[model samples]
Target: MTIQLPTEIWWRILDYLPSNKVKQLGRVNRAFLEKARQSRYQSLVIYEYDKKTKRRLKKIRSSSLGHYVRSLTLCVQAWPASDLIRWDGQTGDSLSVVDRVRSLFDSHYLPRKTVALKKKRLDRRIELIFEAMTAFEHIQEYELIWEEYDQDCPEEFIPEVKFASSLMTIFLSMLVISPLRGTLTKLSLQIPTHIALDCLAAADFPFLEDLKVFLWKSQCSRAKDWDILTGYLGSENLAKFISGLSSTLQTLSISRLDPSINLDRDFGRVFDLLCRTNFPFLRSFDFCTRSRYLRKGTPSLDRFVRQISHSVRSLKLSHLAYDTSSSSPLHHLDHRSWISNVLSVQGLQTRAFSSLTSLRIKDGSLSAHLADLSALLTSVAHQLVSFFLEDNLLTLKEVETVVCSLSHSSSPLRYLGIEPRDLAPDTFDLLVCAFPGLRELSLSFERFTSSDDDVIPMTEEDVRCMFPNLCLDLGFFCFGLMNTAGATADGIICLRLRSAVSLEIELCLMR
Candidate 1:
């Protein structure tokens, strides 16, 4: 007897399988071939040949899987040997770009001479990706990454290794699609060096809704040219590109590799451009790079935030601090700039941060600026649903004040993160009592529990009894009911389910 299953059921079962396992199902039968291929091709990652990463996508170009792909990420290898005399200006050679790149892969190297491969084998890998991309359609997200390389490479990290100009020239001349793609809704790219899009500048991405860029700063060595490079990034072309996305973009995260990049002066033009555009649905923003610092009282970051403040629900200014020793013309910055800028905007006639709900302040403690932080919290407490204050700076009273505010006036804060040292046993109990509606609580316990009395009053059983759905994360063990809580975390993630929590999400039902 033969059993017939609905095609949807077959695909449903295949969805739970591992990607590699799903790929194997393509050979099981004709029914699985289509479903398995679709599942396998939904997301594709192509690691450049020069990377230490294993390459599994060499055959993707010839395959019909391109049509099924929705997410595509390419690690564009840096010209490892750009500085090498042998590799200089070879992109112009009559040799086909693919053939030229293949030669580097074929070359036998000598151990004594570390020629950054003179960017030897990188071209062919890039050539293959560009070739593969042309076949891609209906791709919803695109990412171009130039992975970081250790100092061992001949490339100088002080002045970031750049994508070779020759290769860029050729690629720009022939390259298709903007990093901000019209066909895709999400685009993320790392701008390690100053480069422009002569070919892609004109392309408008009506569908693009999210754009993340790592706007790296020019190395200190180029102090003289720093202004020029940064100014170039905020050129008319880039402004036009961002303006085009105003309608569709909902999330924007501009991170940094060089924290010192002055957002006010360097990123001013971009912010000016963004203010002119309106992102109706924009809701999440993150600038959590640990090293990023601000230079001005009303920095570009502040102005930019105000533009979308009305619509954004999640805002992360983690590691955003005043650069006391900032080299820009202005050396001393008021540390209170970040808080003051966001709060002062309420006086604006255009919009207030009416929809803001989540605020994450990593590496910042409220104790230093309790008054400023408190006032800022009060402004948005009614809308906030989650709050994370890492690097515990708030005293028990302060934490209590914030929690009490959330409990009484605004919606309950579902997520809370704090260090154990800041909250004594009694204080913790009070805080917990103040906010019983918490969905996740993160507590940092390092050396504090050395004394028996310093230990938290609650146990796995005690916590489980309070929040039945809570996922508790103990330092040593993470579980629900018993000592079931999982492995050690420099910090803990409270998993409020299963009467217990485990170290790895894979070990528990969370997976």
Candidate 2:
């Protein structure tokens, strides 16, 4: 007798099985085949295109398997000469991609014969990508990553193909017009230059919920020299595009690797516009810049933060700080007021960020003003479940101030990560007791003493006293298992510390 399970039961059981085991069960019946199709076709990532991939995509397009795909990631890397060989002998749909590509180039008056041989090759790959994308119908998430070797590549290596900025813009414009656009909810574009942003500003993403734009250079572009990129900073286009999506967008993350653009003038304008727009559904907003000083847009930044404070659950403001040393003494006198101007709203200091639970403040000169930092932390302590202050190492006294500020909160925090300029024996006890419900803790100390061996003697006894079962491994001590189940079992504790050269400790516990 054979066991017969309901379809839902079979689905639940298959979800728990590994891919290889699921494949074995897939051959049993049509139901198993359906589950296997979903498991295999739901997410697809193609790094490079070739004869094999072309053939596989053709099969998927002609069958029902394409409909099962919900996510796709296509990495466009520097095309090797072999991958872009002319389609001289191929026929049928191969010729169609060539014709469509040639027509697109012709529209710009870029005659295929006059263009560089490598460019013509690049054109073929771009067209092939377009054709390959038509296979999926229900894609809800799509990531288009332009992967190129940087200047750090070995001198012996030579990049054969060089693509123009306009080509990328054209490709992106066409990509958004696909049939799957209406169904897309998450979109990530990793491209180079503000030209792409300008081109995509007009495209509509009615259902888009999450948008991430990462601007960097491709292999064809030179490194550290952003002067090659033409066109204005697309601030107006970006503001317009984001405003259009405000009704449905829930998460927005924007990052730029190019450091030449002035944050005060470019990003400040963007934030100034964002301050006025209302995002009823927005829950997370992350903006990162490489600027060392934020001289302008303090008022706009404060308003923007306060505008979303009530709705956003996770907030990150990275590398946004003023440089006191760069300013004259007269201007330096206003440092505390400046920090307040950027952090708090006009009349809602305590009520700001009422819904925010996760906050990350990273890489800046914020530690210079201890009082303002303490006040900001104290105000949000009761609501934040995960708070991380990275790259801003506080002194031992400053760390005590932070702990004391957060100690007033009634809610228990689950994760806390911070760095201290120095570490004392009592530091561990202070942190562990400060947040009794902390499940994970990260502490990095810049120095233990003048000598490197000072760290071992400082932490060894304290760690041993706290958890005797911690096993020593390669100068670091660890206790309990690393998995979540083991973390909850037997009230186990895991602690690891390094030497004074760079003393670091990571501890995790339950209850």
User: Best lDDT goes to which candidate?
Assistant: 2
TM-score, prediction 1: 0.71
Alpha carbon lDDT of each predicted model: 0.56, 0.63
- In candidate 2 the C-alpha lDDT for residue 327 amounts to 59
- Model 1: per-residue Cα lDDT at residue 342: 53
In angstroms, the error of model 2 at 133 is 3.5
Q: Which residue pairs show collisions in model 2?
A: none
- Residue-wise C-alpha lDDT for candidate 1, range 139-194, written one tens digit per residue: 78877665545434443532224434334444434434533254888888665545
> Local error of candidate 1 at 345, Å?
4.0
Top TM-score prediction, candidate number = 2
Model 1 off-target regions past 4 Å?
1-18, 27-35, 49-63, 79-127, 152-180, 197-202, 217-237, 288-300, 320-334, 337-340, 343-351, 363-366, 445-457, 473-511
TM-score of 2: 0.72
Taking the tens digit of each residue's C-alpha lDDT, what string does model 2 give over 276-381?
7999999998877654443344556677777887889887767533333545331343344333445544234767777878877764455765566577667778
